[model samples]
Target chain A: MALKVYADRMSQPSRAVLIFCKVNGIDFEEILVDISKNQQFSPEYKAINPMHQVPAIVDGRFKLFESHAILIYICCAFPGVASHWYPSDLIKRAKIHSVLDWHHLNLRRGSAGIVANILMANIDGHRSYPQVVNQAEGILLKSLSKLENFWLKDGRFLVGGSQPSIADISLVCEIMELELLSEKDHDRILSPFKKVVQWIEDTKIATSPHFDEVHGILFKAQKRFRERMKTQSNLKAKL
Target chain B: MALKVYADRMSQPSRAVLIFCKVNGIDFEEILVDISKNQQFSPEYKAINPMHQVPAIVDGRFKLFESHAILIYICCAFPGVASHWYPSDLIKRAKIHSVLDWHHLNLRRGSAGIVANILMANIDGHRSYPQVVNQAEGILLKSLSKLENFWLKDGRFLVGGSQPSIADISLVCEIMELELLSEKDHDRILSPFKKVVQWIEDTKIATSPHFDEVHGILFKAQKRFRERMKTQSNLKAKL
Candidate 1:
């Protein structure tokens, strides 16, 4: 039996796993766990991940959670699939892991959380806390500055050297937040780093065969981001 | 030439790397990054890890940081040295990574940070905002409860499986806080879980080739711990 991936396309980690499966030719059932509706908390889904979180999977009898772990497992399962995705160079691989380790706090909880909370404020009408948003912005900017100044300067990709690594998968997940928060009108936020924008664009294609389908929801998010970006570019302009 | 490790035993992550190296018969220089006085901020060390954390390594021309990442690098560097240190089974390894990922937020920054802060509190007569300690406590107890439910039942190791994977390394680092905070008498806060104790014993012997050194430190910590544990155990034994 093929593996089963419990995911929601709207979830960045889920998309990363999906992209990993598609790129590596690892066939698996994509079981949707709707985050918008809180489907992950369903008793049935909790059985898959007792923690009630997504980007979980079950291959054969083995159930697993945590996006990076799942991605690594899928890569290992695919015997000859690309080693570039994880890399065999111990130092390079460690760099990838270091970035991933740093992400749980910096990007996942900080940047992406801020972007998501901003959107949630709009969607849920909860009074927003200025300090939280400010803290998130500070953390996000600080993390981005570190990544840019330290790792991304001359490296071909973040931690992947010339090609994207699993680190790219994690980065793509966090950068997907840009889709929700990217106001073209307010490009001042991420504007100085055209290189980063290009990298994000490249990460999108790296993770998928069909960019349109894989990034469909993000495209929708980008579409509605007119509040930030006045005119949505029709020419597939690099985000 | 052997790899070079920049660390101070006072840092839990540093100790994790040291214990792992000792256990695996690896030869590496111990370049102490004295953290007690905030020596990690020196320009020399900050260049290695802009985050300026310890437990980093310089292997030939390559540099790697983060204790868990360093552990993987060591395993890959010395593949034949140990097997179960980081298991081969997909599910087993994933559990280890899940715990490691969960560690920075749950254990490392949570309980371990509390331990460090409480250590400073003893000398300086200052406490972190109670909310921070209280929040960390909540996270730790919840995590400990989850661990107790998962690992104690398996009766084997820390990650609820047959062997001690890198998860044990991460947990060992957190538990090392018990030694660090012995003056604060926090072991009993976690003493409810026997597997934690047993697992610590198992890992010390398994990964620590120098059991005498490991026990020596623990013995000293216990000496100081016992003196404080007499009556104050009831006051803050729960931490």
Candidate 2:
């Protein structure tokens, strides 16, 4: 039986995993667990991942979760996957690990927190809390500053490599979520980091159709969010 | 020249890397960057790690940080170290990575946040804020409950193996900080988790003098905290 990947493209990590599998031509079945609809909480899904999170995989009796872990596993377990995705060089691999480890508390947390507070609030039909939004935005900007000035300062990719690595994929997918924000908000938050912007475009081009395909759901959802917000504002004006 | 590791024993990840190197017999020169004294901000240290964090390693000219990344580097870069420390089995390695990734936002964050708030308050001679402490304690308990009921549920080690991996080391060190709390507070928090308590002991035995030696500084600091608190209470009585 082929490996099974349980994912929701709406998730940043999920998109990273999906793009990785697609770009590498890994054989796997994509099992969608729509988190927005609470499908991940179902008893059946819980059996696959007790944590009840998306981006889990089951290969035979082996089960794994956490996108970084899964990404590493795919690189190590599957033959014919480009080593540049993770790299086998001792220092290079360690540097990628460093970026991924640093990511959890910094970029991943900051980006996800900002989107959840701002975009998810609109989706949930509630006003975003200014205090929480401000705090998230602060985290996001600080993280972006680090990415621009430090991580991407000397290289075309995050690990100072000629080719993009999983670290780049994981981080760029995270920043890509900001598209769900208004164009003004997105530009305001992102414009100052020119290097980060260039790296994002480079990563997107490197991954191509896989990146666009995996992120398709998020783009559609973002469009719907804008339409809903516009209609809500119009109704308020009429009232 | 031996690899130079910049560490402060009071930091959990720093302690983890120190213990891993010692236990594995990896030759490393320890360079102390005392965080409490703001020594990590020194221009020299910043040149080593722009992130200004401990648990960074400079192996020859190559520099690396983030404890988890450092741990993996130690495992891979060194020769003749036990494979079980990281393992060559694909699934086992993946599981270890899962635990390490889950750790950042869960055990490490929760435990570190609690210890920082409480211990730093004592160090600064100010009472800890009740609301912040309460919230942190809640997060700590939830994380410990998961550790007890989920991670330690099946095996003597975190990844369900006879031997402890870097995941076990990283997590046990993070929880070790709770010792800085008052005896009563420590007992109240830890007494309920029998498995976690036992696992800590098991992990300690597995990594002997190194674990105890690396932790000696925190233990001494904890003693000082108690002594200071006792003196303050006596002064209050005299007043």
Q: What is the interface RMSD of each candidate, in Å?
A: 1.4, 0.6
Residue A163 of model 1, lDDT score: 76
Model 2 misplaced stretches (Cα beyond 4 Å): A120-128, A231-239, B120-131, B230-239
The structural similarity of chain B in model 2 to the true chain B, as TM-score, is 0.95
Worst 10 residues of 1 chain A by lDDT: A227-236
True contacts kept of 2: 0.98
CAPRI-style grade of the A/B interface in model 2:
high
- Candidate 1, CAPRI quality class derived from DockQ: medium
In the range B66-182, model 2's lDDT, one tens digit per residue, is 999999988988996799899989988999999999999878777887887887686676677777777888888988898898889889999897889999999999999998888
lDDT of 2 at A26: 88
Clashes of 2: 0
* TM-score, per-candidate, Cα-based: 0.85, 0.94
* A1-239: candidate 2 lDDT, tens digit per residue: 98899999999999999999999998899999998799999999988887778899999999899999999999998997898999999989999999999999988778888888887676677777888788878888988998998999779998886899999999999999999987778899999999999999999999998999889988898889878877877888999
Write model 1 residue lDDT over A207-226, tens digit each, in one string: 65544477688777666654
For candidate 1, lDDT tens digit of each residue in B1-239? Answer: 88899987766778778877877779888898888779899999887778788888999988888788888888888755577787767666777787787677666666765665665565344665666667777777777776667655665676665556777866776766666555435665678776666777777666655644744655576566555545454667767
Compute the DockQ of candidate 2: 0.88
